[model samples]
Target: MRELLYEILTSAGRRMNFEQTARLGNALGGLLWQALPGRRKLAVEAMVRHLGISKPEAGRLAKESFRHNARSFVEIMVTQRMDPRFLAEGVTFADPERVRFLAETKRPVIFATGHLGAWELQTGSLGAFEGKRKIVVVRRPKDQALHEVMMRLRTRPMVDVVPHRQAVMPVLRILRKGGMAAFLVDHNCTRDEAVFLPFLGQTAAVNLGPALLAVRARALVVPGFLVRAEDGRYVQHFDEPLDTASLEGERDEKVQATAEFYTRAVETYVRRYPEQWFWMHKRWKTRPPEEDGQPRA
Candidate 1:
């Protein structure tokens, strides 16, 4: 029954032409985003502080961001019904050699990126590039039916999605086989599970799971970004891999340093593609303790 419902929803999404669907999704989703008082306030405040812009500019950016984000989400749902080759044809990689070499290497690698651009396409692009080689992606679980729908939307023949809590073994197995794993590391984390790092000029809580896994698995940590080009195409950009040698002493320090390093990498891309990063989520929900002894809420 759930699968049938999902199929019906997806079929409805696919009924519209690509451009028409994108336009409708963007216009309707942007309006809905603006209607949500809580999310609208959060996005406006974040855009203002993060961009150091006027309230009006922040409002404009928030509106555009919502439109682009909605268009992307709708595109993902609609495009899932299309063949992977057709989808792959539209995406271009900034450094094909880097992506090829990394994906083909015998050494385990950790591919890291934030929720920028059409991130769902990143999975497909990697899958297309890697061919039969598996790409394991760590994801937080959603509600059961929605989770099933998302996994269907995101997974490709060469890409596998693993829930975060149970990802350890599968990730390790893949790493041991010299495979790659990917993660989106920009979400808020509980204080106990995250390390505080500078993100867009403010100290924000960042998950250390990717870094910790890299340290433990001795994998190369590569940061990547997917951004929409001015020409209406998507570009997948890969940066130099992170060196964890400086983080070799204590477990906590290694984790913290890795978190900071990757967070900075994410900040770089976010700065370049400011509107692509998801601003509706409370990225700085976790706060540092007060010097006067009162705990932060």
Candidate 2:
């Protein structure tokens, strides 16, 4: 049943009649609501209130989302990419200054991102640069089939793809060549190396990749996000660079401080659009090991 629905929706992407589209949107909402984590149920419910959907409908929508989420990450991004119209009508990407820099920069700056809103759509703005600047995105490999599709999407002249494990040197090389690389720093893969920082009033394990690279390369570390807008347009928000040269210290301290700063920015942004952020994530994966122990360093 779900596969049939996906096939129909995929086929009707830009060809659906109004009634069919409305029905799909309603189904999509149901899919999303089901996926909401218990911690994020309030956020989902709040969205229902704001959108004026019935409580029952919201609950149903959330369940559908949880189910739909089983689709490959590339599939989700592709769907979002096809609907660039979403950025114009249903989403908001909120940065003006940093986006200007991305297009006009003499050398590339690293954009460290959290899983907030429709982040992939944020690069739609970069597409305008054409040959002048290239955007390379990092992805963790899931399976061979999904990996190939992701690579295909990244093959456009304006974009590049790098696997997370093998991406570091290549990413630096991109910046070395005056192209930009976006890194997602919200997930903490190694508990020992991550620092627990405040996020949505709770401690969340945060990664420090973007900051360290910014410091090592002496390049500006910019925090930017793409958020889902009400009218379907994305508001890509680019914040001014957080200077990391100031944190001249050992590698460990530098990484930790960087984690804290980015998480704070993420927390601030999440508060502005509480429901727009990806809260279902186990952001607070690392906690103090003992009652009196300090946050993992």
Q: Which prediction has the highest TM-score against the true structure?
A: 1
Candidate 2 lDDT over residue span 1-297, tens digit each: 654654554554435432343355446545655554563475456446434567776555445433222222323334325343543444444554555566787666777776666554445545544455454556556666556654554455556667777766777777777677677777645566456666655565566566666666656667777664455344677787766666778977876777677777776776565444544455555664453465432
Off by over 4 Å in 2: 1-26, 32-97, 128-137, 288-297
* 23 Cα displacement, candidate 1 (Å): 2.5
Model 1 error, position 5 (Å): 4.5
Q: For candidate 1, lDDT tens digit of each residue in 1-297?
A: 877887887777767755676678678767878588788788889988887888998888777778777777777665454355654666677888987787666777788888888776667556544543455565656668877777777776756788888888788888777777888899888877777777887878889888888888877788877787767677888888875644568877777777777898888888778777788889987876542365532
**Candidate 1 — which pairs collide?**
none
- lDDT computed for candidate 2: 0.57
Give me the displacement of residue 152 in model 2, in angstroms. Answer: 2.4
